[model samples]
Target chain A: MNALSLRNLRKIYNNGFEALKGIDLDVEAGDFFALLGPNGAGKSTAIGIISSLVNESSGSVSIFGHDLRRERAKAKSCIGLVPQEVNFNQFDTVKSILLNQAGYYGLSRKLALQRTEYCLKQMDLWDKRDTVSRRLSGGMKRRVMIARALVHAPKLLILDEPTAGVDIEIRRSMWQMMQEVNQQGTTIILTTHYLEEAESLCRNIAIINHGKIVENSDMASLLARLHVEHFVLDLARPIAAAPVLEGCQIERVTDKTLSVAVPKEHSLNKLFSQLTAQNIEVTSLKNKTNRLEQLFMDLIDSNPIGSKATGNK
Target chain B: MNYSIAFRTIVTKEIFRFIRIWPQTLLPPAITTALYFLIFGKLIGDRIGTISGASYMDYIVPGIILMSVISHSYANVVSSFYSTKFQRNIEELLVAPIPNWVILGGYVSGGIIRGLLVGIVVTLISLLFTDITVNNIAIALSIAVLTATVFSLAGFINAILAESFDDISIIPNFVLTPLSYLGGVFYSVNMLPSIWQNISMGNPILYMINAFRYGLIGVTDVDIQMTFIITGGFIITLTLFSLYLLHKGIGIKN
Candidate 1:
């Protein structure tokens, strides 16, 4: 069964801006999904509509078999949305915020308290539960939001840029916690600008641009489409010119840096051998950009203005 | 869907919100009410003597209590709802499975609670200055609750239409304060010239104060029956309007 299904979802704002234009999407139960898009690419708008924070102009959204329009309560109850912004009452304590959110979902007081404690512990915020939300660090606040969303234990969780600003350490910890949650059988839908995070965690991915989905496929399949990968190599010594190598294009970025694009059919070993033949010593190498980021950019750039691309696996 | 829990949560949060900041929410009104008794009841009432067979201080007590109910109720909802909107925490409720009516009921109940609590506090202060006797306990209680409900709903409407902090204060400062004063809190409408007395009848607060005054001191300028009609009319109209605003997601949602 699908945890979420969006059929022809559309949203046109009051200011005559069309944020979403007839997009359809589905995430199977217990799947870890990524909904990636650039800024103002209608990612948040779509999530807003799904979460019932924004009214849809037209379309249908269903969660766990409950139609959003006709069975709003059931649909909403099935979703636990961690919005990109920090939206909980700042004056409220951490425990109170989670308990209140649980109560909003109709959990009994005793049950809410229990869930609040469990979620706080899961988020590593048990000690800070009595502190006001505004007093917490930014990363802790983000964790509180995730914990609050989980207090109700909804089947599908929607996280909108849940780690946009946190330090790397906290981001990785959140990723681990999310994986644990997914492993426990809760479907997760994450929207983020960090392609590496999506590439690493999401099994299925969807890239939206200009209010439409441009690419929707499983992670490996999407990455498989990349015929070439770009890597940046740092030289042990300064080089004045680019190296000429077969099946690879190399450009001199700086005195000691070389930018190379190696086709998938050509192994890095052959490129290195060619460079070695030219007496170029390599020190370290890294991808010029995240692998998935390259493909996402390609997909976004390939579609011209006001044009649509087939968004199917 | 556990509407009971949702409703309870919103109400509890609202109550806690005000109570958590007792210095801001509950203190000012008590001090202000005491000052009103000291100045108006003691200083001014002593000179005015009496109106409508009751001591001037005693007659003003009911109006003073009701005024507290009206302003506090309106202030509670307006400030609370507008703060939620301003801070964007209203998304917490918007994304929930709670129905619009439940949301409306929860906030309004919070306002009513604050209004009545302040009313109780003011009444206690009123006792400090003047001897009070209830002409009809049921009528007094009924009018207090009804008046609180009416203002709470009105406050909800104001919060929905308000765009800024200034917008929220405009109605209470410009409209509510003028109307409450002109509602005859310190003076009976009978004291006014015939034309002015007729003009005072146009203010809704006039009827509420008089109805409450009649309940507390058995002295009223307007007919008790008319009070119920006007108060009930305001309640129904404001309730529907508030629910309409919520259903449309005005001010709070995009």
Candidate 2:
């Protein structure tokens, strides 16, 4: 069963801005999905509609078989949304915030308390539960939001840029926690600007640009469409100039670092061997740019303004 | 969904919100109302003697208590709802499965609670300056609750229409405060010239204060029956208007 389904969803704001233009999407139950988009690409608007914070101009959204328009309570109860901003009451304590959110979902007081404790422990915020929300660090506040969203144990979770300003260490920890959540059979839909995070964690991906879905496919399949891959190679020793290689583009980024662009058909082994033959040694290598990011840029570049691309499963 | 739990939660959160900042929500009103009793009821009333066969100090007690109810009720909802919107935490309720009526009921209940609480405090302080006797307990309680409900709903509408903190203050400062003072909290409408007395009848707060005064001291400048009609009318109209705003997501959702 699909955890979420959006059919012909549309949103036009009061100022005559069309944020969403008849977009369709679906995420299967328990799937880790990424809704990647750039700023002003309508990701937040779409999330806002799905969460019922923004009224839809037209179209339908269903969650776990509950139609959003006709069965609003059931649909909303089935999904949990972690908004991008810090939106909880600053004056509220962490525990109170989560418990109140649980109560809003109709959980009994005893049950809400239990869930609040569980979520706080899961987010590693148990010790800070009594502190006011505004007193917490930014990353801790983000975790509190995630914890608040989970207090009701909704089957589907939508995270909108949950780690936008979070430090790398906390972001990785949140990623691990999210993976645990997904492993526990809760479907997760994440919208983020960090392509690497999406690539690393999501099995399926959708890239929206200018209110339209330009690419919707499995992660590996989308990355496979990239014709060229760029890598930054750390040299074992300083090199005089760029290496002479056929069927590849290489540039000297520094005396000891080289940036290389290898076509999809060209083997990295071939380039390494050629470099070794030229008496140059490579210490370590990493992708210069995220592969999904490259494809995303290509998709956005190819699909200009006023162009619409149909989303595929 | 357990709407009972949701409603209780919203009410509890709102109550806690005001209680958490007692200095701001509960204290100032007590001190301000005490000063009114000291100056208007004691200092000035001693010179005016009595009106409607009741001591001048006792004459203003009901009006002062009801005035607290009106202003505090309106202030609670306006400030609380506007703060929720400003902080964007209102999405917490907006995204929930709770119905719009439940949301409306919860916030209004919070305002009513605060309003009545302050009303009780002011009544106790009134006792400090003047001997009080209830002419009709049921009528007094009924009008207090109804008056609170009316103002709470009005505040909800104001919060919905407010674009900023300043916008929230505009209604209470310009309209609500003036109406409360002119509603005869410090003087009787009967003391005014005939034409001005008729104009005072146009103010809704006049009916509420007069009704409450009749209940507490058996003295009223207006008919008690008209008080119920006007107060009930405001309640129904404001409740419907507030619910409509919530349903439309005005100033809340884009």
Candidate 3:
């Protein structure tokens, strides 16, 4: 069964601002799904509706086959949301926050305490359990939120930009922890602007722009759809001019570095053979941009008006 | 869903929040109550003499006690709930599986507890200046809870409409304090002209104070039965209104 399903979800703010036009999505159980969008692209609004934090204008939502409006308790019980911003009492201790969140989900006191301990330890916050939340570092606070969200052992986890302000090491650690949770058979839905993070962690992705879904496909299939990819190659010898190759574009970025754009239909062997004929040796090679990033940029460029709606705002 | 656990958790957290900052939450009201007794109950009572066959200090004790209950209950819910909104922590409860009534009841429970706690403290302080007597202990406690519940609901509405910290304080400073002080905490409304006394009857705090006073001193400027009816009606109305606001996702939602 699908872990979460939304049908024709719509949200119009009081000021006549339509945050979500109509969003229909489904994330199957045990899948790591990515919801990608630019700022104000209705990603947060959709999350808010699923979590019952915002009132929907019209639509239907279900989690594990329980209607969000009619069977709200069951629907909400199946989901855990870690919002884009830190949203816990700063004066509260980390342990108390987790314990309270567990309590909110109807966990018994004994169970709440046990889950609090387990989550705190898992997030590496056991040592800081008694510390006031505001006194902790940014990353520590983020982990505390994650631990709180996991305290109830929810079936579906939704993280909206959870690693936005976190440092690289902390981001990787969070990603690892999320992967561990996902592996434990919990369906995970993540929203982030970092395409690389989505590429590495999410198996399927949906890109939203101007409150509409622009792309939705499995990660591999979507990446494969990227026809053109740019590569930066380090040359063994300095070249005075850019290399010339049939059916390929090349530019000399620096005396020792060369940039090349190769289409998916073309082979790297053909480009290498042509370079070898010119007596040019390639020492190192790397993608100028990841496949997902390249695809996201191309999609955004193609739909400039929709992208601008999220961009300028 | 386990409603009891959800309610208990929210109540426990709220109590902890106030206890963790006792000097700020619990101490100031105690000090304020003491000063009110010193100036209005003692120094002023000595000059005013008898009011309704008892010492002025004794007559105003119930009013003063009700005042503390009103202010603390209103203040607790307003500051705590608004702070949650300001800090964006209200989403914790919003996203939880708990029912809207459970959330409202939990917050009102906290406010009632704080109001009663402060009332007890002030009542104990009033003992130093005046001999206290309760004609109906049940009535007195019930009235206190009812009054606290009413003010807590009012405060919740204020917090909902408040856009900033300044907005939270505006109604409390300009409206609540003025109404409470003039609600016959220090003087019986009967002492005023008939026209003024009729106008004083419009102040809801007057009925709450008089009902509490009737419970304690067995005398009230307003009819005791009508006082109970008004207070009970307000409680029911506000409870429904507050729940409606919460269910509508007003103020707290995106």
Clashes of each: 0, 0, 0
Better-scoring candidate (TM-score), 1 or 2 = 2
Query: Over 4 Å off in model 2, which ranges?
Result: none
Using lDDT as the measure, name the better of candidate 2 and candidate 3: 2
Candidate 3: misplaced stretches above 4 Å? A304-313
DockQ, 0 to 1 scale, candidate 1:
0.87
Question: What lDDT score goes with residue A90 in model 2?
Answer: 94
Which 10 consecutive residues of model 2 chain A have the lowest summed lDDT?
A304-313
Query: How is the predicted docking of candidate 2 categorized under the CAPRI scheme?
Result: high
lDDT of each: 0.92, 0.93, 0.89
Per-residue lDDT for A132-172 in model 3, tens only? 89999999989999999999999999999999988999999
Listed models, DockQ each: 0.87, 0.92, 0.87
- Residues A57-76 of candidate 1: C-alpha lDDT, one tens digit per residue: 99999999999989999999
* CAPRI quality band, candidate 3: high
Of candidate 1 chain A, the 10-residue stretch with the lowest lDDT total is A304-313
Q: Comparing candidate 1 with candidate 3, which one achieves the higher lDDT?
A: 1
Interface RMSD of each: 0.7, 0.5, 0.7
